[model samples]
Target chain A: MSTEPPALSADRRREVRRQALSVGAATGAYGISFGALSVASGLSVWQTQALSLLLFSGGSQFAVVGVLGAGGSGVAAVLTSTLLGVRNGLYALQTSRFLGVTGVRRLAAAQITIDESTAVGVAQPERPAQRIGFWLTGIAVFIGWNVMTLVGALVGNAIGDPRTYGLDAAAAAAFAALLWPRLRSGDAAATAVLAVFVALVTSPLLPPGVPVILAALAAVVVGLRRGGRHEAPPTSRAGELPGADPVP
Target chain B: MTTWTTVLLACAAAYALKLAGYLVPATWVEGERRSRVIALLPVALLAGLVTVQTVVGDGGSLVLDARAAALAVAVGLLLLRANFLVVVAGAALTAGLLRAVGWG
Candidate 1:
């Protein structure tokens, strides 16, 4: 692929921005659920907002809140969140070459390089649009997500019992949604199934957070055992929004 | 540690990992064998989370409750390719209704 950015027609430029904004809006809107779920799990509204502003990755944010809600240790929550955030790192590796960001811009670029922005950035046909798609989607999501998170946290705080609104179940559904797309292959599916069993079996004996970590370790073993087999790397599917549900 | 400390530490770790990608050499994450493992890490952890959330109850004892039913609803919605909000709403509605009706 040529590194040179083809000159975009004005229409193309507008089109890319439109796509970026729309993707940002859609993904950011989901932050409401995150906020509600976070507070229900016992975080203060400000803490929930902090996760949105600082952690920023949708999947990682949910993982942290979910673990803590389940009575997991803080160590467990951090480890789980870190594991989920690894994908964002991989995404950065892919985007950094084209992004060519530096100093403060580099830091800013790193902050917003989650699944949605990376997906939108890579989906564009032209180089300039890629950058535009990345930045616009990142900024838009940043603003929209934080605002919606505050709204959701406030509502959730006001609502009293989370179970009254099934927020617990909502958290489960979020995990299921994130897991669904990753189950594209037999090996991935097998890993998930086994991981679930491991988690369940160990839950009664181990601490809240340890079971998930053990399950992740199991997946590493599986991955290595099956490593040489031909399979599409998960990053190739980066075109799909990381946390976005599949369109019906 | 306090939840506040945990939150900050986790956020810091997440940011560090993201920044590492930009600063570290590409060769570190290169190679199919290693990358494939990296890819499946979330799959495993997420599946574990879903299991724990859906079935494990107080003291981590396995219990089939409204959450299980709600998860079933979530699966059905997912099969129909419902968007994220719809799936979550469907699960929450299902669980809430079940709880209202005195079911687990």
Candidate 2:
């Protein structure tokens, strides 16, 4: 990676900012559902808002609420969320090469280094736009997510019964949509099926969050037996080319 | 521990992992097999989550209820290539309607 960034044209810069902001806005809008769900799942409004502000990663935040909502222990909630958050670390691996920062800037980058930011960052041909895409998207998402989370949390607090509105089903559907795009290859699909089966079989036998954690072993089994052909890391596939597809 | 404790701890762990990626050398984690497993981990976890969320109920009982019907609707929408919000809303409406009609 070159330290000297190629000069970006005004039109190119404008295009990159537009892409980043739109991605951020769409993702942040989705945070409303998370806020409502977290409250319905037994977290206080402050707690839910705190999650959006600090945890920031959509999948990990969802996992925490999901696990806790199912009556799992705090340890299980933390473990499941942490497992989902691991991909952000991997995304950071790619973004670090393009985003060479230090001290306060480096800390800020690490905080916002999520799927959306990394995806938008790497999609750019030039380094300058890449930096803009990453920062603007990250900051936009952070603000939008927190604000929307507060609104949803207030609404959720007012709702009498979450089941009446089918929030539980909405949560399930959210996870399904998130998992749907990842099931392209046969090995990945097989692993998903196996994981689902394991979770179902163990749901009654084990605790709530424990089954999901145990189900992760399917990846190890499948990955070892079947080699991955896709050269680009899986995170790149999660990029939102248009605003329609929202990636967590 | 309290909910606040869990929330704080979880956020810390998640941020720490993200920071670790930026701080650590690429050589430490760059391996084909390792990355493949890491990549597939979320797929497995999310699938498991969908199953649990759809079918499993309080006390970890397997209860095929309106949630199952909602999940079916969600799968159908996904097949139709509906966006994320549409799929979620459709599933919620399905479940809510089914429950309203005196069905599980």
- For model 2, how does the per-residue alpha-carbon lDDT over A147-241 read when each residue is reduced to its tens digit? 88898889988986888888878888888888887777777888899999999899999977999999999999888774456333434344444
Per-residue lDDT of candidate 1, residues A165-215 (tens digit): 788988999999888887887778878988998998899999898898888
DockQ of 1: 0.83
DockQ of 2: 0.84
- How many steric clashes between backbone atoms does each model show? 1, 1
Instruction: State how far residue B57 of model 2 sits from its true place (Å).
Output: 2.2
Off by over 4 Å in 2: A1-4, A226-247
DockQ of each: 0.83, 0.84
Q: Report lDDT (Cα) of residue A242, candidate 2.
A: 21
- Cα error of candidate 2 at position A34, Å: 0.5
Could you tell me the lDDT of residue B77 within candidate 1?
Answer: 96
